[model samples]
Target: MSSLFGILSAAGQSLLTFQRGINSTNKNIANVSTEGYNREIPVFQDLPRSGVFMNKIIRVFDQSLFSRSIDLNQKLNSDNEFASGLSNIETIFNDALGTGFSSDLNTFFNSINDMLIKPDDLAARSQFLANAQTLVGKIRNTDKALEDLKQQTVLKVRDQINQINQITSQLAKLNQSIKTKTLDIEVNNEYLNERDRLIKQLSDLIDTKVVFNEDNTVNVFTAKGYGLVVGIESTQLSFETDSNGNAVVKWNNVADITKEIQNGQVGGNLKTIDKVNEQLNKLNDFVTVLTTVFNKVHRQGYGLDGSTNTDFFTIDPSKSGTKIDASNVYINITDPKKVALASDPKYLNSDNTNGKNLLGLKNNISNLYTNPSQPVLTPTEEANLKASLNDPTNYDFIKTHTFAEFYNTKLVAEVSSTSSYIKQQQQNNKYLYDAITEKMKSITGVNMDEELINLTKLQRSYEASARIITVTDELMQTILGLIK
Candidate 1:
């Protein structure tokens, strides 16, 4: 009877252990579609001279794989953000769909070429003035678009920082709750899953470095070593507007971290804004050269009204400080008769010398993209241009490249090339991110078929343990009956 009782006790413990195994398998199958969930496994230990019993449940996770996935996640977000912002800027300059600055520039100059046929034709002069206004409108509109884009990008960063704060706050709370996880009877999986999910969410907004703690909580920091979370507490990031009305990212509302954010969405946006400002400066330079050359040549010619030395293009240099830019550059001449067509006032309507010489200027300074260096101006033609080009000190770029070619070669080409490179990197990192995630999933994600098989085995083992307990009870009853 004593032996039967011992057998019964061991069989009962075995039954409980098999039941625990089935519970773990079921838990995995139930959470198969859950994001950030790890499959749980039942660990059993055999007692001395007794049956096996489950000790605890452990989640299937690989530390190395998890850490690598976080890194790829931030990098992929950085490139994706850059690509998105760059597309907006590219669209502003791209004229494939409509007439942008480049197109208007060609039309403005081509209109001048048309006027050469009949210098005194008021209809031709009127069309030339109209084209000039269109060209100026394009430059001003482009400047406004670039300004709007930068402001919009700054707003976007502000929103992302707010999102980062929300994630950090949740992460701190998860840390406190998950401290009791993975150790005792409270083997809570949701706390750990939510913690990891928050970490990935934070990574998308900015670069993060995660440190796993022994208590099943995590400590996170920026790649630049700014701490975001310590133990169960999280730090909040904020921003301030500088005197120039630029957004400056602040850490803990005290220290400026604008330069420290070298990855993720915030970093991408900052870089994009920097590029916009750089192009803006280059545009200003191109405008200075353009206004100088066009105004000077126009002043040297005479209009139908015998107007000379009048600026064809004007800019408020006082507001612009050092030089004219797209912001202030505009047509000074509204009257079609003010369109200077004669190089000399004496040859106003018949000679066409002044207008012809103006046409020679465009040909001399050939558009790098459209044509190569034109044959050098004849000595007589060079003499005629010298009257207007006397101030060689003012025009530097126009000596070699046309207005359109200068902007296209310097500014547009740079943006396009940089954008293409970033897009490629974004694509490549996406593939890498997916690969790392899949690898991590292989170890941590539940396999439906595998779980079902394990469930079946657990069921069989549970039944066998029940049968043993029954048999031991029956044997004990027989012995008891004999003794009685």
Candidate 2:
């Protein structure tokens, strides 16, 4: 009778075990399509029976394997995030290649070269001025585009921070739930699934390290050592513009978090914006120098037909901001008919038959277009030029001899090199992104066929266990009838 009772108890335990197995199978099937869901299994163990017989059934997760899986999933998410960021950065600069400011600048310089062949022609000069205006317009447009990109980057950072906060909050709530709930294997499995999903989400925002605490809670931190989530609370992040108009990102209103937020979308976007700003600054300086030098040369020359008091160009000194405004300057030679040596009184006694000064002025203007010297006026030179223009002491020499050729060459070369470097960086980013994305897909992406197979197998195991329980019940009924 005791042996029979032991058999009955073993059968009863098997029936319960079968029911839990069926539930686990159903759960796996239901969540098969869910993103970030890991397939779960019920682990079984035999209880030591009295007098050399096994009694109860024990089912739990393989904790070592589950923990390792979680770690791998987090790594996969981080790599995917970094790849996505790099891809976006590549797209921005790749599109910048054909229809960008660099192309526009090349066209504008070519137009200037075209105008130089006919320096005396008023229509040609007008075309040159128009191209110059267009060039400045392109610079302004490009600078604005860069500023827009910077603003977009700031917004992206804010969005990511918001997402991080939401995930962390969810994690904190899960921590509380897990601690309060009873540790039935079935219930713990559900909590673990939710925890894994939140962890993956957090991983995508930034690379992180996960710590499993004693009470089944997770502690998350950046790879660079900034806390994300701890027990029942999360550190909050915020972004704002500083007094200097630079974007600042902070955490907990105490710690500086920017450096720790590395290699993600926010970091990639910030890097791109910084590069654009640097390029814009270089271009602005180029334009400012061009305008300054051209005005210096134009102010010294007498008007066509040589009027001593007349100026060929008028430029506003205040237009020398970080941005170039072409409206501040005007080339006043409108009439082609008035462009001869005798148009002004200064040319009346000025070697009209030889036309030396007039020829020199035309040559100097042509040289400006062709040679393009840098505006290298030192403080002393600028002061002398200003004094000479104000008081008229050898105005011709100051105008022609004051320009520096080497300085202009160096500036042009620098701008050209910078543009090239930016292009190269964009290309390299594309290659790196593609490679990393392919690697992540291999590891983290779902295999539908494998999941279907597992589902069918678990379903069969559950049904077999149910059949065993039904057989045991029938056997017990027969025994009771015999006893009666």
Candidate 3:
């Protein structure tokens, strides 16, 4: 009877262990589709005498693989964000769309050339001013578009910082909870899953490194070594705006981390800000050169009204102290008779010398985007001049140094090259990211088929244990009846 009772006790414990195993397998199946969920596996230990006991629950996780996934996710996210923002900028300068500065610039100069046909025609001069206005409008609109991109970047940075803070806070809380739960040999798999999910999310916003402590708490920090969370204490991140209201990322509410964010969405936005600044500066330089060259020739010429020493383009007073180019360039003259087309006052209304001088700009090239050692005209610009040089008598004296040539060869080409490079980089990252993601899923993702097999195994063990208990009880009863 004593032996039967011992067997019965052992069977009961075995039954309970198998039941726990089944429960764990079921849990895995239930959460198979959950993002960042790891499969749960219940570990069993044999008792000193007999039977088995549930020792702990271990999540199917590969620490190294998971860490690598986080890093790759940061890079992938950064590249994707940059690609989207760059695409927006590329559209603003696309000459194929017919909305580029090149078209407007060509119209403005063509109007000036048209005036040479009817040097004293009010309608021709009026048309010149209209085209000039259109050119100014195009420039201003381009600047506005860039400014809008900057504003959008600021908003995106702010939002990303907010999300980072939120994620860190949650991670800190989960770290505390997981620590407490892990104090026992059997840790709570649910808390661990939640903690890992938050960590992954944080990784997507900014680059991060995670370290797990023996106490089950995790320490999180930026890849640059700034602490984000340590022992349940999370530091908050915020934006540090410049005087111009441009956003800069900060770590722990201090230190400008904008440049340090090398990967993730915040990194992408930071890079976009730099790109915007670069284009803005380039446009400003082009404006300075354009104004300087055009104004120099205009000052030497005589307007229809015998005007001299007047600039054709001037900066707007409202934009004083600003960069004072592109967005602010305005035509200086107000009178129709003030359109200068001649170098001599006696033939001011009939001479086409200044007009032809302006036309020469169409083919003039510089070392804008070429090697400094090679300052010769670009073949593309020369080809453009040749293509438009149908009438040598009408346009032969027309100079080859136009704004269109400089802009197309220098700024447009440079931006298009950048766009192509970024797109290629994005595609490479996408491929690498997809590969890493599959690796991570294979290591941690739940498989319902495997879970079902585990369930069946647990059911068989449970039934065998139940049968043992039943047989032990039956044998004890038979022995009792004999003794009675």
Candidate 4:
């Protein structure tokens, strides 16, 4: 179907095609260990009555695998943030760290029990006051710590939002470049690689959806259907603070869509802020109820100074309300002699009846320590308190237990349970995320062995094509000698 010159030209074309294939294999081998690198596949097309033609080189890509990987990565990041936040909260209440509120509470209550035995001893009374002061200081410090954590979460969220904006902008720019190259019928493997990498990065900061276009541009969106990028244009996300100082993710500063952002570091930071605030609220409530009940009983007793109605602990005057918060709790009475120890004693100096009565009040104080909202009660205390209330005759003052039973049973137990649940969730997420990530790598990742095999094949083809060119030249030389 062709002449000798045509045959020679065809052989030369075959040589070039094979060389290009070898070059592509070499590139693949070079980047085999590169992170996020995809294997380049060289395409070949048969020429019309010729040998072969080299087509464009494209990287091996699985769009579906890539999209799924993005989703899993976002969730993995969110779970990590959540687990770290829960650990921080656990540290706040960890008794092993020597900073737990439970320790201070136990010490203060033990000091009070000792005071009940030596109500007239001034030294015991002073120790009781000192322990109470220490307890208050611990509560205040804990509250401050939680506040600081909340602020940190807020700042992290703001930083994440900024990063997200930056990522989306870059994606938009890459989208435009890719579209232009594709429209011009140019090879765009580099642009495609960059775009895929950018999309994955965007998904890590925030959950994203990508829709590919015919022009090689992709439209990116938030999981909530907010457009991140459409063709060449992109929108930026921002955060607006609510009156409570909570950071709310906003779409163009128009709507409050904080709840829509889930499964990313941004979402996790917001959720962490909420978790920290929840624990802070519970601690404040405990402080309020403790101060209220203690002061209530102290009010019923007479001090050594014969003060009939003295408030041992006071709420801040500006913040005084029906309930006392930890931030506002203060020791109202300063004089150690002002410590109440008599309920209806004949002499304030010699009366241990009030101290004994205060101990008796511990049984009734179950109602104060047990948060009706949370309803976290020790089963025994709940049943006993119910029974005592129903039949006051069965109430035993000698068997009363207050602070120790309630504090451990309610707050400490709750923190432990929450921490355990968060840790389990993190482990499960990590396992799932790792499995998916490995799957994606297997699909798109370069294989050195496979590349070597391809390289050998290309080398053989190149040698064959070179031999054909040499044979054609030798035959032409022989024909020319015969003609001469």
Candidate 5:
């Protein structure tokens, strides 16, 4: 009787095993089309047989294979981040190419050259003034465009930081739930798969490393070495805007955590901001030099009609004192009544024989960007020129020089170089992003056909397992009736 009981118990265990197998296959088939879901397999182990009779079933998952899946997920995430950063930078630089400031600078100086050839013509003077206004407009437009780009970048950074915070919070909650569930091996595997998917998503926003603890909890850290998760809780990151409207990432109100978030989207954004700031500073310096030199020359030169002391171009004193507002700069030649041709024919003379005192100003304009060796005008020379313009000692010496050429050459070169460099960077970054994205797609992208095939396989397995359980139940019923 005991031997018969053992046989019945073994048969019952086999039936239960078949039922569990059927359930697992059905579950896999159901989730085949789900995003971020990995195919699951039920592992069966034989229980210790007594007198050659199998008694129980144990199901397990291959942890090594699961770990490999997690690794692949992380790689895909990093590739996505690199591709996104490159694409964004490309867009910014491409837009910068159409600023049009370089051409305006060239035209402004060309008009001045025309005026020099026909200084006696009032129309030529008027044309020079018109071109000057156009040049000012170009500078203002270019400055504004750069500022806009910078602001947009800041906003994007802020948005990304917010997303990071949200993702981290979700991950923490998921971790807690996973720990509390105390699920079977199959269910635990599912939890791990979900956790890895979330980690991959977080990786794209910022570079991170995931550490799986023995307790089935995961700890996350930035690639640059800042703790993002501890046990089942996650740290929060946020962005703060400074007075200049620049966005900065912070943790617990402590600024300067940017370095901790390296090799991810956040890192890419920070690098872009640094590059933009450098470019902005260089542009500001160029504008300051252009305005200061032009104003000095304009203050020295008398109008073509030899009017009393007045600056040919009006410069904003506010700009000269501190921050240079390229937008606010304007040509001060408001008095159309004061406009006149150079009074003396000798004004074109290089020597004192010419009434004009314009010396070296024309050469200065033409050589501004071309000749790096050109000496900057000294304070003493500037003061002397101012005094000479007030006293009118030698108009002949001034005739050879003018304000138009000097300002135009430097402005044109700076604008052209800046625009060109930005465009080139944009294109190069775009290519890199495309390449990385293609590689990532090959690795992480889902194949619907493959998934469908898997679904069919699971469906067949489930049916076969169900049939085994049904046969086992029929056998048990027959044996019970025969025993009765």
Candidate 6:
């Protein structure tokens, strides 16, 4: 019961609807190689009577796949950052390269052996002081390297926070644009894609959570529930120096979240900073042990000049602090004749008892060099290994395990083990991230051949609908001719 004009109207509307489908197909073909682009499908709904109309779009995406991808990306970044920091620390302790504290320590102790053999040799005493200076330089350099690494990591934390804030701010803008244009399918689709891209980028800097809203807006939060983006407003993260001069991450520039972050670049930086501080603390303890017992013994002995009660180790006068920090402790005796090598005034120049005693201290401190075949510590020994760190004067424990053992087993080995673990974790995370990415691509990636076929079908439909319109117009013309 429809008129000819009604037929023309349906055909005309169908042409536009089919054209929309064609445009979408062409777009899919055009963007086939675009990264992070999710191909879209234009859904057409049948009209109540006899026509079809273009409806909403169904973006090809799986939320679960996207979430997993972000998770793995953040984890991989964390491992990468940790590995980079540890690499620098490993270089500091590379003894095989002849640049570490081991050789200097050996030379210093060998000088003591020379003095014990020839008590009248002032050359032996001078060589000992020279070797001691070299050892002190090595320790100072190691401490400076660790401190530098920590400062660099702290800067990384601050930089990551800034990056996170920038991403969240951009996300907030996208949310506003998306909410305003929710009804505009084309514009909103692009906005959603951009939002997803930004979210993935944010995950690289910090661990975050993304929630999709009913109105197509997204809200972002930290893993610990700190709001980053909500509706159209974004809360930013900031960094400040705490009382200890360590950088602390904060929410709204107030509440500290430095320890709260556990993954991504920020988490890795925080964790590496802790490790640097640990090494510094251990190095300080080692210095305390070196200066404490060496000075105690040297001060009790007598030099050729009958010098008595002369301290062997003191802070560099040029330095401002009194603490015997690793970086500040130096050789205080420059005069070879001032070297204390006698236990008695009766035989000050002839007897080498004090020289022999000093050699004994050196032997115990570097025991691993002379006895490398010592068995791995028992449980009791392992428990006592760290006791010297609290009280470095515990010569009972120090003598057995030796300073060389503590440095190698505890310091060097810790870096090596952590590096190995992180390398493995980085490899595992890459595998998992790749697997998830492949799945996501299969589901959302554009298929050029499929899109071409769809384009052909849409073109044919559009042509047929145009033909109907042409035929109906001719029929109307003929009816007008009859009326004339």
TM-score of 1: 0.86
Model 3 clashing-pair count = 10
Candidate 6 lDDT, 112-213, residue by residue in tens: 888877777888878888888889999999888888888888888888888898999999999989888856687778888898899999988888888889
Question: What tens digits encode model 4's per-residue C-alpha lDDT throughout 162-224?
Answer: 998888899889887886676322257778878888887787778778898877689998887
- What overall lDDT goes with each candidate model? 0.78, 0.52, 0.77, 0.75, 0.55, 0.81
TM-score of 2: 0.66
Best by TM-score: 6
Arranged by lDDT with the best first, the candidates are 6, 1, 3, 4, 5, 2
lDDT of 3 by residue, 284-319 (tens): 656655665566557767888888878889988777
- The list of candidate 6 runs beyond 4 A from truth reads 48-50, 363-399, 474-484
Span of 10 residues, lowest total lDDT, candidate 4: 390-399
The clash numbers for all candidates, in the given order, read 2, 5, 10, 0, 14, 0
- Write one digit per residue (lDDT tens) for candidate 1, span 211-318: 998887899998887889888898999976677446699888888989888678888888877778776766766666577556666776788898889887788554
Candidate 2, overall lDDT?
0.52
TM per candidate comes to 0.86, 0.66, 0.88, 0.86, 0.69, 0.89
Residue 83 of model 6, lDDT score: 87
Q: Could you tell me which 10 consecutive residues in candidate 1 have the lowest summed lDDT? A: 366-375
Q: List runs of model 4 lying over 4 Å from the truth.
A: 182-187, 316-323, 360-363, 366-406, 474-484
Clashing pairs in 3: 360-399, 360-400, 360-401, 361-401, 361-402, 362-401, 362-402, 363-400, 364-400, 364-401
